[model samples]
Target: MRVLITGATGYVGQAVAVALAGAGHEVHALTRDPGSDRARALEDFGVRPLRGRLADRAELSGMLAGADAVVHTAFDPHDPVGADRALFGALADVGGRRHLVYTTGCSVYGEHAHAVLTPRTPVDGGNLRARLEAELRSAGLPHTVLRPGMVHGGDARSSIVGDWFREARSSGPVHRGRRDKVWSWIHVEDLARAYTAVLRAPEEHDGRAYLLADARPVAPLAVVEAAARAAGRTDALAFAPVEDEKPVYRVFDRDEVIDSSAARDALGWTPQESDVLAALPASFRQWSAART
Candidate 1:
């Protein structure tokens, strides 16, 4: 199958492209800058790099011409509804019920305090997740939606959790919220595999949603501590809640859990990395090495 992956040079998109290409599928990697180092890196893994932005209708339509499926991961979170609708309209006019898979975050369930979240949970009205959800639904295609949890890994690049780990190394301590919130987490590789599984079996997942979280949730303090231990800064670590309103800390300042059993049962997807806490230290160490 020929699959066109938008944002193919991005963190998640690159991982997904690699997985699909490795599985013997032809991958069309759409990116804004074909001359970029990231785009060239995709070529190393046998991905066909194509230059196009999401806003370009002619380019997107031409790219979709020969694609058997499209995984739309390229999105502007603040203003995605317009682009999403345009893509959906184009696909509809193109005259094939091609499998369209859209990616959203698990935050749409929004602060799952007491109740566990599933695909069936009602979404919050006034959050980024809700707006994204509304856009996906309005697309009017039998699109498969994947809601991944706090995606970490990739050596502290483009990951909030990875950033925290790096910050702990440089700043001596990392801040967490006052609450002992347990966040659902997913490694970039694992999340990429989920996309591959869906692409392979799109017929079974049209108009369906899946949560791609690891089997367990980790505490914020635990992750910071892991990074500290990895850097051999056991004495240099101090954990405290953020008193001031820093934007990045807000996402980690909440509690949420996800039920990814639907994804597991439906797509035969099973996450191999069950020990996130154990893995965090090494990830941070590698990230530090890359910088210096």
Candidate 2:
């Protein structure tokens, strides 16, 4: 099948494109700068790199022409509305037969407090999830909405976990928030695999939203300590409540995990034990090499 992936320059999109191309699917990717190092990486992976942004109507319409499915992973973290609207519009033009899988964050469900978020779990996103979901349903296009938990790896600035890890190193020992607060995270590769699985699925999931995560919720304090251990920092870690943390990470300083049984049952998806802190073997190797 021919697939077009948005945010091909992003961590999730790049991994998805690589996975798709490796499986012998014709993969096309959209990027803002086809000449970027990230774009070049996509090209090296055999992804047909298309030069364009999501809002570019001319490029978007043309790109959608022969695509059997589209993975819309390109979302603006700041203002998702524009990208969401533009991408949905483009999908509508592609007709209803093609599957349009839209990527959303589990953050839309907001902080889960002490509960797990299943597909059937009640969601509260201050209308954020509702608006986007409404758009997905009314798109007049075949669609699957995916809400992935904290994506583990990306560019340095892109990885919130990486930031916390880096800060933990400088702050002496490790500083964490709500050691008991649970966390639901997904490895970039596993999330990518889930995306690919959905793309290839039969007529079971349509206009359905899925929460992508592993079996259990990870505690924030444990994660920071584990990450410290992973990075070879055996210092004692400090635990603080969300209220005391800086703006740097106070928002993400809560507990949330998703129930991916729907994804597992529907798409035959099973995530390996790739913890967020443990999933960055490649990045660790690169970081080590750069120092040498």
| Number of the top-ranking candidate, with TM-score as the measure | 1
Poorly placed runs, candidate 1 (over 4 Å): 111-114, 240-249, 289-292
lDDT of 2 by residue, 51-158 (tens): 878776656878888888888888776667877787778777765477887887765665445467778876664657657877778766788888888767544335
lDDT of 2 at 269: 90
lDDT (Cα atoms) of all candidates against the true structure: 0.77, 0.73
- After superposition on all C-alphas, the RMSD of every candidate to the true structure, in Å, is 2.4, 2.9
lDDT, candidate 1, 98-165, per-residue tens: 78888878667654454467888887766665775676567666678899887776665677666666
Alpha-carbon TM-score of each model against the true structure: 0.90, 0.87
**Model 1 lDDT vs. the true structure?**
0.77
Error of 1 at 77 (Å): 5.0
